[model samples]
Target: MKHLLTLSISIFFITLFPSYSQDQSDNDFKEEVKRIEQLTIKSIKLRQQINPEAEQEALNDEIKTLDATLLKKVTLFLNEYGWKSKKEIGELANMGLFLAIQHSSTEEMESFKDIIERAYEADKIEENSYALYIDRLKVRNDLPQIFGTQYYFDEKSASLRFNEIEDFKNVNKRRKKVGLAKIEKYAKQNNIALD
Candidate 1:
């Protein structure tokens, strides 16, 4: 009788957990592990094989974009801590990046290290601050930018709702109207992009 009761309990559990039985299959788990391992290896290889020059160029573009938007928010952040330009903010970003090392994936840690090393080469920032700032940015990805082009900053609301979004209707109403005067003056002065 005891044996029959135990057999019934085993049958009930098996039926209750069909997915678990399949999950425990050796081939299924091995394939999953193999795929994850391949991805991790590829990320590591890319991090190691990329040249600093290519990375620097990318970072320059990023800084330019950030200048138009993120730089303002970062400026506010630095002001709270007392800082000025991108060069100074880079040091602050480094400090955040360093703290992020503890929670980062191996590939992320490598990139953080690369950023610090590159900053050192450029003589723009100290290693300690570089580490810290990067980490802070990673954690604050959700924060809205308070600076940059006033147009974008004006659209941000603490909460967005159907009616509240209408607040953006005139967000750019007061934005500086760029025209021939500015464009021509800028282009002729720089000898660059033309219309």
Candidate 2:
């Protein structure tokens, strides 16, 4: 009788715990659905009037809405298409239908690209390379802030630069660097180049 009771409890717990985990996953999926819906509505309303800067703004909002997992998906999709930076998404967006087709597998990305392309072609709008710029901003956020403003890898110089200042001295010298080694590790894991 004890053995039977123990078996029943174990089976019940195993079944119940898995269901709870599935429920959490479902909840996350639902939230993603809601976010996508909101973006879709915004895209539709802004479509005719959208500028490249405005479109970039929308992209930033979408990026913020994405969880880290979804960001990885976006990054993977970008890499799959051989994109290097945010500028690529913008350029592809300008290329019109081909870009849409290329990202057809990503529903929101496809839709957003279409809208941006249509707006750019219609309005002849040109904005700063916010997409490429945003990628740099994201990278900066991932690193220590002490790296200071405009810090970027000067691949040509083979040194990290803070602002226009190439020389890192004193505290600037202590700014932790993200070298090719780190980028390579990330690239290997994501099957994408860091550039």
Q: Which candidate is the best by TM-score?
A: 2
Against the true structure, whose lDDT is highest? 2
- Misplaced by over 4 Å in model 1 are 1-26, 55-195
The residue-by-residue lDDT of candidate 2 on 59-116, one tens digit each, is: 5554344333333443444344332222433433333222222223344443445444
CA displacement after TM-score superposition, residue 34 of candidate 2 (Å): 2.0
- In order of appearance, the predictions have TM-scores of 0.23, 0.28
**lDDT of candidate 1?**
0.39
Worst 10 residues of 1 by lDDT: 145-154
List, residue by residue over 1-195, the lDDT tens digit for candidate 1.
Answer: 999999999999988787677676655534433433343333344445534323366645543443333333323333344322235434334333232342344454454455455655675554334423443334345332221111111234422112121233332331222111332343455443332
